[model samples]
Target: MSESDLQDNNPLDPGDNSNLASGEGHSEDAPPFVPGLDGDPGSDQEEANNLEESTPVESDAFNAHVFEGQFEPNITSYQIIWQGSPNYWAGRGGNKIVAICDHIMQGSMESANSWFKNAASEVSAHFGVARDGRIYQWVRVENGAWTNGIMNRPDTSLPWLAEAIQKKINPNLLTIGIEHEGLTGQVFPEAQYQATLWLHRNLIQNYGIQPDRQHIIGHYQIDAVNRPGCPGTGFPWQRLLTDLGATQPKTTTLTSSSSSGGFLTGPVPGVVSGAFGPGTVNTNNAYVRSYPSFGAGVMVLRKLPAGTLLKFIAYTDQGAVYKGNSRWYLIDFTDKGGWIHSLMIS
Candidate 1:
């Protein structure tokens, strides 16, 4: 909850932030190529309405700070369930933490968790809060989930998002997203509110995020044109800020760091880190294969232009050796996310 819990390794320059403002940012599978739009408000609100309130369960465990911004064994009192998702950028590609955005799943937490786990979906938020006050973490705070990627809508008038839009940066890089499992218009239960309140306070404390309307915002603010009712009108914004109660931002600057091509937090004690960031295509008309290998049965998903940006999710030697190298990288895309030989992206 504290920005202190998150780090800003690659602070975004106000100008370079503009380079990623609109398009060429998130993968195509991601939504809102235009603006906010989650079709049916709450496809399963009836099911969510019957939820029971849960007491905040205490815990002393930590998380494996997936990226530089988040520290391992996340410090929290509430029992947090961690389920790592592949649908996120390994790191912010150097952008620092700035705001925490809230979203309403309009469905069940189980659905959100399942969606995030599927790499083919190419979407994720950092945390998810169930109607019963249970907390679940999918993507790490340090990485950029596919949640709020770009401000592509024509109308960019929301004050809460003015600074973000003017900066012209990929909102996903600067923001940590927390999804609430519920509908847009339904009243939030006290237990759920308190749980989210604890998270917001911690984010403010750790990252130095100011406890205010602008810093702590809803998903609608970013793309009011399309998703004006995202975290819905029922979210108690004023109450959350009042409870947070730190009048001013704790610090003037945010800090973060990256490893393994700007991938993980530092090194996990036993897990080995490898190249896991964005890479440019080095070859001309390269094909992203259905599988990592070059031999039989592999289908060509599509062709890529030279210098096209590709998100390399993981590296392995499972594919047949190509160009005297066995390194094959799994790249995230709209179509089931294909794997490309390292030589094309090396």
Candidate 2:
């Protein structure tokens, strides 16, 4: 469908985004979970120190397109407009983009489109994906959009992120922001997911961005304090990472004993409880969502690393099944009940 047609069908009126700033489109109030990290607060300091000691790589080779005056659209198949008032001039010769970040409108596509076009909101993303998977670009890939507020700061704490920020490579300049139409923790439509996957593939290939967790992170990872549950927990991160051929890290074994603050670590030797059986997560970075379904609004509670044992307290026949199983198991994670696809559990 065309961009105008998609906007016309949006549920919210144009420029009416009252819920975006409220808790409507935000993720649940949960502690920040960084993939490949053990959820240790001190890890950030350690990483920062390591980055300080390492040699900084010159990004001159990555800026050839801007220097040569050759600009290519990241997604040529979508509709785009030069709504220039809301964005900033990306310094570093406009060739600093190296990552892709996702966000939820927490409202309607029409509202988001209008907001970016209004110039009053002072926020814009490079692309906006409608529920039907229609894509609209507000800013060119070469310039920085004001979608992410964290980009305004330079002293990022994460070691893997320190170098990028130190070189002024914030999300506004180094990442292509794509806002999806939906609330936080809601299921994202299949079409929208497909469109995002296509866009990501092109961006990764075109920008030479390493298809890994560190490079392609959610908004929460950038500024966990202010944007904790952005793009929410239900965003099938493992599936996307696997599809991108991103390198996987070795699984960390969870320790047994609920008293130790670990959920079920590994499978219980002899545990059986009808459909609510016990199983171990076989894949690293397996997602436990608030709902069984896959979509934009689906909330992810936590991403359990490999070998975390969990009990299948309940099951749902509905939802996407990656493996041969169509059932999703509900489990208690972090004192809250959440769902996970049965295929990821052993």
Candidate 3:
């Protein structure tokens, strides 16, 4: 997917060539076989994933421009799905395009090997989809990259949503929206949820976003005004909040019973009774990872601050803990280790 698709009004106008980075700067120049996803080991996707969405004032109005560094060499390849037309979300005359990527594949070969190279010929990169839950960005967050039009016509307004418009639902500037391929049906893949939380939390920290959660709204919540049942009813809303470390009213108390291998119990009460029984399996997909040192540590990450309380969602014998929507944290209890606090289990 080309970055040019995101421009409504280019603030830099550095010419088409400028935005297109050459071999030294952009990772697209690298061959499909790279070691890490972010192009470099130690190049934390969180650190290099700095997206600068500039809202420079011009002509008494705000002009938005999305400035981003090149993709990491580890991001082997990308499939541009649509380019000319908008996706299913953009009403009818929207300018948005969608792209799907295989981010966590092995050397040169996509783990799924299912490539839709021709997809971009039909749409733009207004939205991106990843097999994992992570959403690496390519566009700004303010302009209507073309998801939906504010003005349907000169006369007779199409009842354009005032709140949505005010929120700048433009696929161009206002959002860096992402769709997870594995999030089909009511359940999302364990890998997707964990990766998504890290991607989002990093984005929040990198951009210094206020309220943190405000910048990251789900596709379901976006069309809440006009469309109903968007993003589906089963979309993990609470998980998203917890993944981003955003605060919300407690819906249900997630408890970690000493039985059941000390796994975090589900919403139901007394079903498992926290017993470590036959069905209990130690897997990484069971919980969220809460890193205290931000982004450095063991197979999981780092430790949380002392006395920092975390809500527990589930557990995995894979040495990880899941706390929030997509928040999967590694469980550690060493001198350099950390602890995870649960809402139900103190």
lDDT of each: 0.56, 0.53, 0.28
Clash count, one per candidate: 24, 14, 45
Per-candidate alpha-carbon RMSD to the true structure: 21.1, 15.7, 21.2
lDDT of 1 at 93: 56
Error of 2 at 215 (Å): 1.0
Over 115-135, each residue of candidate 2 has an lDDT whose tens digit, in order, gives: 665434556677777778776
List model 1 lDDT by residue over 1-346, tens digit each.
1111111232111112111112222233253322232211112432132122322223433323322244324433566667656665555657678888888776778877767665566667888888888898776576666786445331232243555567655677778899888766677898788789877777776677877755786765565323445676667765888788845323211111121222222212212123354666654667766555554565666677677876654555334543223445666543235666654553
Error of 2 at 82 (Å): 6.6
- Cα deviation at 134, candidate 1, in Å, is 0.6
* Tens digit of per-residue lDDT, candidate 3, span 44-76: 332233222312222112111222222223322
The window of 10 residues in a row where model 2 has the poorest summed lDDT is 5-14
Which has the better TM-score: candidate 1, or candidate 2?
2
Model 2 regions lying over 4 Å from their true place:
1-18, 21-85, 90-95, 151-160, 165-169, 256-346
* TM-score, prediction 3: 0.32
**Candidate 2: what lDDT?**
0.53
lDDT top scorer: 1
**TM-score of every candidate:** 0.51, 0.52, 0.32
Question: Which candidate number has the best TM-score?
Answer: 2
